[model samples]
Target: MGRVGVDGEQRLLLRRAEELVERAERSGRAVSRHFYTPAEQELIAGAFRGRTPLTLEFDGGYEGAERRMLLLYEQGEIRPEPPLTAVAIEFPARAAVPAHRDYLGSLMGLNLKRETIGDILACPQSPGIVFAADAVCGVLYEELREIGRTPVTARPARLEEIVVPEPDGILKRATVASLRLDSVAAEGFGLSRTRMAALIAAGGLQLNFRPCESPSREVGEGDVFSVRGRGRVVLTHVGGNSKKGRTFVELTCFLR
Candidate 1:
């Protein structure tokens, strides 16, 4: 398929998400599922945007999972949890493994889309992958060959049972003048408003993973945004106004 622009991709993903929601409602089963990038997950949530009869949930097996899988269902279906299977791929010790790239490449070599898999936790002992059970669990458990420079073998496991290293990221809290995206981003990242405006105007920033050139756009709490060459941050909370009437926002910027 040809590359779709950000707007096109967002529309397409929203449509698919709604379709899944409708299917789940009609079938009365929690049988609908889709893999979503962090940004796509945000888009999907926006598709259902307010209080509705739909149930949408996300999980990547453990806390602070980056690439999450989205599960959709009606209010009282089986459950909103996607059918996930944890596959721990064991490799020889002393084998250098590029967690994300290597395991992802091997899975793609199996003709799997990146969405079919969730977080690929790279542990020194072994790396684990959370895969959508309906499509990839059996195939990978039966067929994965190698990951990067390490010979690998897979087996079924429980996510809660595994102890993996924390994700490679950091969290920081900052108080900004307002929720205007560029302004908060500027403060959190230690850039001047002029520089931030320049970046936004140059199409070097993304609001919730979609291209956003407007610096004055209002960023709500819980929105994850990125600035090219600077890294990504999540607006963890929107607090009350500051002493001088400025908006108080708390955000965590993930280190690149």
Candidate 2:
């Protein structure tokens, strides 16, 4: 699924990437674009593979972020900081905790492009932090006063102030007939094989951060499977076959 077909959005993003690279090369300086999802970033990477000598760097406001901005620079140019800022939305202690989608929805209501926003970390009983482009920090600070009827105080904060919680994952070991995407994903996500296959066919599954519609796709040890509305699972290890001729596998499941 990595740049297999150039859709309109992918083509536009690729063109922007090329323009940024050309600008960086011409001016002998670093240039960057707004945030991009992992899929978009992969597309950009595939399009530029071995095609340009410029160095490419990606960074979100924090480490282990799914959405990040791309930086293009030369070998000796001084790399500029990523134009990212953190907006902390503090909910009242007694207020019901807002879901991630709630925060994102409120932001979108402000007429902001999705690309300008990064990750929204919803911390329980604590201030939720949103990583957005620096250009929108003022608007977010000024107008973002509520999320889905719950009043919240939004303020711009330094990136260092963001505190991301550790991922909570449950480790499970299982044996499957094969390492097909459906087989491993069903076991890891506690779903029936039929249901998993249907989910894949409906474009609800992502193999290694790219939407995959093939349930029979061979999955490897390091492959990650993500299902929207469910959670993410990583195929951590592949071991020897069992006595019943089933392949042994370990997975780390992160439930939403």
Candidate 3:
């Protein structure tokens, strides 16, 4: 849920969580609140029959579409249509977005960096904003321009297709180029680096199922790296140089 990847451990944990949920239900602890009482149900039926506004019910954990419906209900009858910004597409990858069509809706371009993205998203919707998922960030700028929008960049340059996930929980991931190991950890997880050496350590963290355990390991550009608690990070290359002639790196932070 934090970083994104395919992990058998995650599946096992989810399965266990489901088992616990079933046990809780058997104990009469889990209840659905979307159901209405008799009077409310009758009122809802009348509203549906007469085309009146129905007081809809929803569970306590409503989100996305459900959350929107509840808020609209609380705001009273539809009356005149409320203002809505045109749909937007956002490019949030460290890589530049490729060119593509909305094929769906209007496209708006807002200049923003990979950082401070949340602030741009919080503004009221406008015709020029297409809030895209992370998947769209590697599209070509010229391709995007032909479709009537341009890619915003931190620096002026033409980048290539990274073929990376949006990191938003929907897309399946492939390989990442590189990863970062904390210099100050003083140890691997809790074990000493030397002591942790020569162990299988197969799936603890990997790009495409290759063992990458050394504290000095280089994750490479475009690698999908996962740590147990740190979540998943994509090793996106920006630009870099040698520090005292030792290779230093620049990477983009893709939160999962």
On lDDT, the leading prediction is 2
Q: What is the lDDT of residue 220 in candidate 3?
A: 57
Q: How many backbone clashes does candidate 2 have?
A: 0
**For residues 105-215, could you state the per-residue lDDT of candidate 2 as single tens digits?**
999999999989999998886588999998888888889889878899888765656889898999999999899999999999999999999999999999888889999
Q: What's model 1's TM-score?
A: 0.81
TM-score: which is higher, 1 or 3? 1
Q: Please state the error at residue 45 of candidate 2 in Å.
A: 1.9
Among all windows of 10 consecutive residues in model 3, the one with the lowest summed lDDT is: 62-71
Which of the predicted structures, 2 or 3, would earn the higher TM-score when compared with the native?
A: 2
TM per prediction: 0.81, 0.86, 0.23
Sort order, TM-score high to low:
2, 1, 3
Per model, state how many residue pairs clash.
Answer: 0, 0, 32
The candidate maximizing TM-score is 2
